[model samples]
Target: MKPLDDQQQACRDWFEGLRTRICDEFEAIEREAGSGASFEFIPWERTDEDGTPGGGGVRGQMAGKIFEKVGVNVSTVGGRFSEEFAASIPGAEDDPSFFATGISLVAHMANPHVPAVHMNTRFLCTTKRWFGGGADLNPPIPYADDTADFHAAMRAACDAHDPEHYPRFSKWADDYFYIPHRKVHRGVGGIFYDHLDSEGEAWDANFAFTRDVGRAFLDIFPAIVRRRMAMPFTDADKARQLEWRGRYAEFNLVYDRGTLFGLKTGGNIDAILMSLPPVATWA
Candidate 1:
């Protein structure tokens, strides 16, 4: 196994910590909500560009009677970001030199009332370095309180790092997560910021902000789920869930940079695609 690079090591450490924290919090939330939620951590391994260097990480799944399914996957894809990665986005074609420390995560909730969430943070280093990641919500049945609570939790998390961050990133998310064809948002927007630089102390601040949001996830998600998990669902709600999932499929396959990056970098296929929900319906 080739030695992990500095950035790769950092990503591995941070995600390991995050995995433990999230699982513990999930367990606590399940107990309190009286939901029989339990999770399974699946250990996985993969090779680098040449299949010479190897690395491994954990993927987790949580499901219950009340909740359909929730998946959390963490992996490090180390090597030059593949040509496929660059090709996925039209403008990225000219970029030649590429090296990246990739970390991606997403949570899918079973209840239409609660909403599904996705987040990915990565450090891509060429001659320059930057951070990118954001969290967004996808509620099946939109309710004012649920949307407000979800956004408020995210806003508080961002504001803790910098007050200006909330509006700036929230707008970015709204724009980034939109579906032009559908003429609707993937969900009520949260925070999305990308390409944060290391110059003038912004690097430190950006990571600090990212860490704060990550830590805040444990608190934010369960609160929303607790309130909505027991709510009654009708066939209509189920139909909407399937309809919205089609939009999600479009975004992940056509637009998600992380998904593209993972595929390009020779990452594990199952791990890279784990962001997809267990079940989805079109139209």
Candidate 2:
């Protein structure tokens, strides 16, 4: 898609910048957190139905001997939103017009104590483009302090741009991250919202908000890692971690609209599935 508007360009640039910052920050954090860690960025190309070139993304994987796995991925996909694609996702049945562009990202941490997190910040245009995406946590084992810390960091980020954002989106995260059958949350929630328009002053404010959250990830997650990474995990803890991972895979495969949308749109399979843990046991 042509970069026709300022907001679209800004969103693109922001994602580029975030990709760099996250990779660098994670490397440093991994070193401080423990040993036997390594990260590699995977490059991907986006193509049209006829194999015509479109766009691409960067996928990064960080694995440690101490921890199971960690991955962070960023992608920019633009083109027509097909009906077939819309039908794949749970709520995206409307099948908007032919023009869509945005960045989607997800981060999964290896340590069961650290929690897995996902975020997709994008500026998508149908009739007109709009911004969406937020960060949320999914912990295998609940730690109230860590949960509180994660939320507080997210709240602070939102508050920097708009004070009203924290409470509104916090509740949104809580509602979105819930698993009905289990009667439990995927994790202590952070924030989730979509369909933000770049009209009035809202666009500028939201851009700032998005940037704040993007930067906040580096600050919030590593601290949790430092606290939990070296802590001894028993066989039972490992078993539970794998069980929780199964739940994670279920949510992404069954419930997450983003995963469905990506897969249906012919997104990079490896990058899309980066949210899955490196090692998981169903039973």
Best by TM-score: 2
lDDT of 2 at 16: 74
Per-residue CA lDDT of candidate 1, range 1-283, in tens? 4466665477567766877777777667677767667888887776766555545556777876544666677765444445656554333466634445544566666667778877666665555667778777788777788778778878888888778889999999999988787787888877888877754477667767777777666677777777887788788888888788888878888887677666666667877787787788884
Q: What's the count of clashing pairs in each model shown?
A: 0, 1
Listed in order, each prediction's TM-score against the native is 0.85, 0.87
Error of 1 at 108 (Å): 2.9
lDDT of each: 0.71, 0.72
lDDT of 1 at 179: 79
Clashes of 2: 1
Residues 51-155, candidate 2, lDDT per residue (tens digit)?
656566777777764345666676666665566665543334664443344545555556566676776776665555557778887788889998899888998
Cα misplacement distance, residue 189 of candidate 1 (Å): 0.9
Which stretches of candidate 1 lie above 4 Å from their native place? 1-11, 31-37, 83-103
